[model samples]
Target: MRLLHSKTLEFATFYGDATPPYTILSHTWGDEEVTFEDMRFIQKRKSLPEDLRRSPEFMLAFDAAARLLFPPNRDPEKLAGYEKIRKTAEIANRRGHRYFWIDTCCIDKSSSSELQEAINSMYSWYKKSAICIVYLEDVDISFPAGTWELAPGHLTRFAASLKSSRWITRGWTLQELIAPGRLTFYNKDWEPMISKYVAAAAISSATKIPPYVLATGQLHRASVAQKMSWAAKRETTRTEDMAYCLLGLFQVHMPMLYGEGQHAFLRLQHEILQNSDDNTIFAWEPLSSPMLPSIYRGLLARSPEAFSSTSKHQVERSYFTTEAKEGIRVDLEKAPLVLPSGEVYYVAILGSANGTKLSFGDIHHLKQFYMFLKQLDEPNNGRRKQYVRVMGIPNNAQHQVQHNILIFHAETICVRQQPIIPLNFETTEFSRFVLRPDTYSATGLPDIQAMTVWPLGLISEKKEIMIPSHSKDFTALVWLQEHFNSSVSNVQVLLKFTRFPRVGYWCDIITGKQWPKDRDSVDEWRKAIERNHSVKELAQRKRYRIGTRSEIRTVSIEPGIHADQICLFVNIDGLII
Candidate 1:
């Protein structure tokens, strides 16, 4: 760590444990600001006898020579950034602190390793500082020093000034404001406005940070999502710095990838997931209006802007922590709910506040924080289950009052942090439909040999449906519509996906002449098929034949593209079989 002498701006280096206490500065950079290399205030003194060197005569001559060494234009006093350091140094000296750290001139950012370490250690650096000084360039507030309380008039002016202060909206200042145990705010003229302890409430109201959190650097009490929300509105000059600026608040470290753009936030979340199992980390939604497939994104959020509403509520750890977090997977507490349109949406409970039983009844209401999830597809080959968030702006982040919700308790769902777009996001059934034909040998089945499904190239590419492969009972619904001839002879076939008895699938027709609107309407038909054609477990090498045939027409199920998909083929003989 590098420190600047409080009286003289001479720089010095200190290592771990050996470093002395120092005051730190936090301020938004202006159009003209000093940088690390700009702190070039050199005073040269010739070697002299101790008595003579300490004498006023020798000091005057040394000062004159130093002035001649550098031109007036090169003076540090001319830089807009110099005054911040000078004032911070003066305050540090007044507070009996010999050393102070100002970000602009303290660290050598030119060195990559040094910059990385400094960024990762920034939060701790501010936390451990003897004093944290914040300079607000937009406001000029000067009040009585010993009396900490602001008058009613002063309070109004202070709130208005703090509300519009640019320091509150900058990315780096978030951690700087929260990491320090002792902090003071100064206005444009370098006059003290109010100490953090004295104005924590006002500051919290303006900045949306909890008063207690601002008073002390006890970050563990806040959830990862909440901390992230504090940074959601903060702006950083560099695109990646938005995520980089938060290293200290989360207390996790990873190599900085400056060019990654929004992906840096993704990496930050992954890092947070590794360090802590706070489920709120996944509790964010985008602010933009979503397009068809864009709405179906991965569990991980794209950026902190998605967490705009996260800090509004107190999301805490659920009692079901063990279930929510597996060995490495993040499992959300899930319950299935039926919409008015009868679409099944799984409510993935993110994290609950005090009212949950896990809270031991600290508060009255039992609130469950959740987001609506529509299962897109079951976990393919034991991978993460795929789901799409319920589109449209959510009416509420919490579940509706008890009586209105009908929650079917189901096991938790494990999803990946990166995106898991449904396998057939933008494509149609024909694109994903997999069919393996059944070849007959010398069995003398003349009817089967001449069968073929026609117009395969004419299949429309517009139909969409969700398929689940989570268990042995993998289900999918596929439709086959005959080409329109303006004739009643056109048949609409509903191929109900059944068990893959062996290599071949066994599907029963749910409805014959006309397709029913919903799957529930065919409940009795499914039951009838179960009784008449019970699924017989076949040997691995053998295949099962399914589907009833009329004299003129025939329909049967074939092996699909995947174990979870259903593919249909039709054969029309001379008769209606």
Candidate 2:
């Protein structure tokens, strides 16, 4: 089987490198090679042709046709397991079960037009799927395992570049990164399998409507939280109704990536969608199987109201991890078990003290954290609770008031309220997000995506300058100069300056020129600074260096000069006098 190569496709596959074990299969059913387009058509059975419609014999033929597209390989555990499930599913289908859709087999690879059609509808298929099977064949865990492993250096690095790197796109969502690329194909699988592709298409299509508008529409149509509340109030028991209720959530609340139990939940949703109503919600309770955590079930049983929406409380409860992480100096011992759905939240069993000051910002942040925890709460008789609470801290009885410092127990703290957290950032750590030149510009002004790329620099002249990405920009420069020095903090940016190369060597922002020579030492950097700054002694005291750039030059800035005041000299002449 031959693989088609394109700049974006190749880049995606390359980045995917040993990061994950991706299967390379030809789109061939038996002897005929299937094109990607065919895979799309097959994947979107909802849009299948007359011939493609259901027939036990046709299904068998289609499955056989899919086999040829796969690359030859000894059965790896995941593939082998998938194949086993496929066979069983096919058997069920033959017996007149509605249908079983597996992306690898259902998608036709022979047609791009068809694939394009299906690609746009991926979200619906996921949201509506009976089950979404997430197969994690491999994991690239180059990062250290322990939370304390996150040191000052790590935090600095995070603070400096966390806002502007492709790292977020590295793990499960690489499909979104390097998007409009083949990795996007994997995106189809990222959705809830029980869903169809219609809503996804409408939201992502090139129509004049804004993307967020479409997203908002999807959110509106699938108001999972509203319905869940209704279901709870009505005391619905039909599994199908409950599943539909869950679908709204799977699409909106759950992380938009493949996860354990996500697929099973989708399947349960589909079954419930087909068979039950509010009264039958509990009928499928027995069928819940082991898709999501039992804790969710416990929560559902206790206070069905909790699963309504993803809010501050629910987020904390759902994503919170109890593992004490470094830099997070909260005493779990003083905290109580928080159930976000109900009012059961961690109160500072102790209040605040003036002498022992705690940042109100921390308290606010903790409030949001408590919100997440509230959502994770399930209704249970007072006998036992599914969650854990901290106990037995000696009350600072000596102090007038105790500070009830708080944090969320979920996955990562920063992601929960990025806008606020980015500003309150007093830590030695940085947050990074990477921005593509084309994507940055396409996003239009004040590119938040660009700002996420820390120690920011531009990929092109057209794109607006952002704080983290354009680290050389006056503001970014000052921030770097003042804060960029640390084991954790490092700045390496790629600039796509519009103009051509200059005669000498150095990264100059004014001319958009890149010099041929490299500045290797701190002394060399000092010389460069001396040329730029009149105060030679100041230049000596303030260290600078050549930071790496992609297509253009990246210069190191020292503390004191407000980044806003410092201008990138297109040529030496452009340097501010």
Candidate 3:
């Protein structure tokens, strides 16, 4: 059958014997008759939905109504274009009620009461449609002429039309961006594609302008609601027709929560009726407009084939057992955990493993390991002491430590690092000395052994000397100068602390008292502690070492006794300037 219709062809031949309940109505000119066909169809189709009332009586009433209280028909071509729309509506109705109630054909023209009732209930009808076909025939449905079947031949045309269409390219039409949340309308510049089609239809009908073409006007004379009303009066069927078309085109082109099937039509009607108003425009938004688009996009991105399948998140599973005294270690260097369903999770092992020992990286690995251990039904049980030995490191330094294990909370992650680098410098008497103690305590160090180095800024071994969290940006720099500077600008100082105390609960090695070896009182060291502000310039200090070979010799002023003092003083600028 030829797709295009000649201008204003009378439907008398189609209705000649097609009895009542089948009157043709143009949704654009509500209750208004098209030509004189209504007089013939009135008795036959008068009992149907009012939208079908293209009878002369309905038009007369509609016209009289407009003259009484409503405005004039400003959009005449949109009025004349009604017949062409009715023809297109015929094409979408072929599947019986498989596509019944195709609004354009079902509404009766002789009954204004039915028309009013239908218009008022329009939202529900559109929402419940079996197959809402959006005849973006106004925007050119992508396919060859007369081709509506799903075929390979239609694919190329579909792609090409989509690429060149102003709707998709400029993102300016209802069909192009119908996400869930907010309703959008295109501004004028991108109106060319659809407007040109309506314009051509208007010209063919020998009309000056269509109602929708008034959308071309720069002035915003009508509120969106008012314009909808105008559209409604022109033709209730076309109003709902286009709205259904827009909604259907949206479900097809953009993201929708449902998939294709027999239910596609039902879902379309539900969505359209739920969202549209009596004027056949969108209703007030039901969801948060901002989040609606995201939901829409998500629906679009979903793979339709997998809609009914179970999801497998990329997570790994493992099981292991360890002995009480000797630990059993399984290296996880980029290995996948195998599962019964053939699923796998990749894991990378950071290793330098030993029994009961945990390194800093090992400490982090323990948290995940603990979870795995619990999965295996094993507990810590307080029998094994965890130890960490630095065996092979990039720095080539070997050190060992017995970790004081504490139960870690499930939600808490690893501790944060401090600014100072831990100086494990080897001294002659004591092999390793931690110059900065703040770094140790931040990592939860219980205590430090051997050589004592007290940083002057620390109030005690218990507290750290760092800028407070709430201070303004530059406050740390200001505090740095107060303790170290006589001239503030160029002065430098050193502060140190021992993580391990020597004798009492809180005691450190002090000078200027009796030496443990010689028992001689060194008064010179006492004078240095009193001058706490003195900047140490290392270039001027006399450095002496004491101790035997292979027994690391440390720098010393003189051997002093360990004292029961809560804190110690060290002028670490190397030499007082």
Q: Show model 1 residue runs off by greater than 4 Å.
A: 40-77, 145-152, 289-294, 319-328, 340-342, 351-366, 393-405, 417-577
Give me the candidate number with maximum TM-score: 1
Q: After superposition, how far is residue 494 of candidate 2 from its true place, in Å?
A: 26
Kindly give the stretch of ten consecutive residues in candidate 2 with the minimal lDDT sum: 415-424
Tens-place lDDT per residue, model 3, 377-423, is 11246423221111112111112212322222211011111111112
- Which one wins by TM-score: 2 or 3? 2
Model 2 per-residue lDDT tens digits across residues 1-577: 1111211121122221222222221111222333334433334543556765667787666656655754443222234333423442443344343333343433454555544434444444443333333322221112233442333343333223322333221221211211121111111122111111222332232222234323333333322233333333222233322332343333332222223323434454333334322211211121232221111121112233333232112211112222121111122212332221112334331122213334223554432222212122232463222232212111222121234333322122111100111111111111121122222123122211122211234223433233231122222111121122342222223222211121111222222222223425545543443344333221111222324322222232211111111112211111111
Error of 2 at 160 (Å): 34
Q: Please, what are the lDDT tens digits per residue for candidate 1 over residues 1-577?
A: 9999898777889989988989999999885566666565332232356787789987877656656855544545577887888899999999999999988778788889988988998998999999899999989767777654655566667878988989989999999999998998888988877878888888888877898898877888888778888888889998889988998888899888789998898788778877776777767877755422223445677777888888855645652332223122444565655433233566566543222222212222435556666665666666556555554422331223223343434344554433344423321122123323234323322232222221123223322223222222333333333322342222323333322332233343333433223434446545544554443542112222223323233444332223222233332222112
Which lDDT values do the candidates have, in the order given? 0.61, 0.27, 0.26
- lDDT minimum window of 10 residues, candidate 1: 354-363
Clashes of each: 11, 119, 49
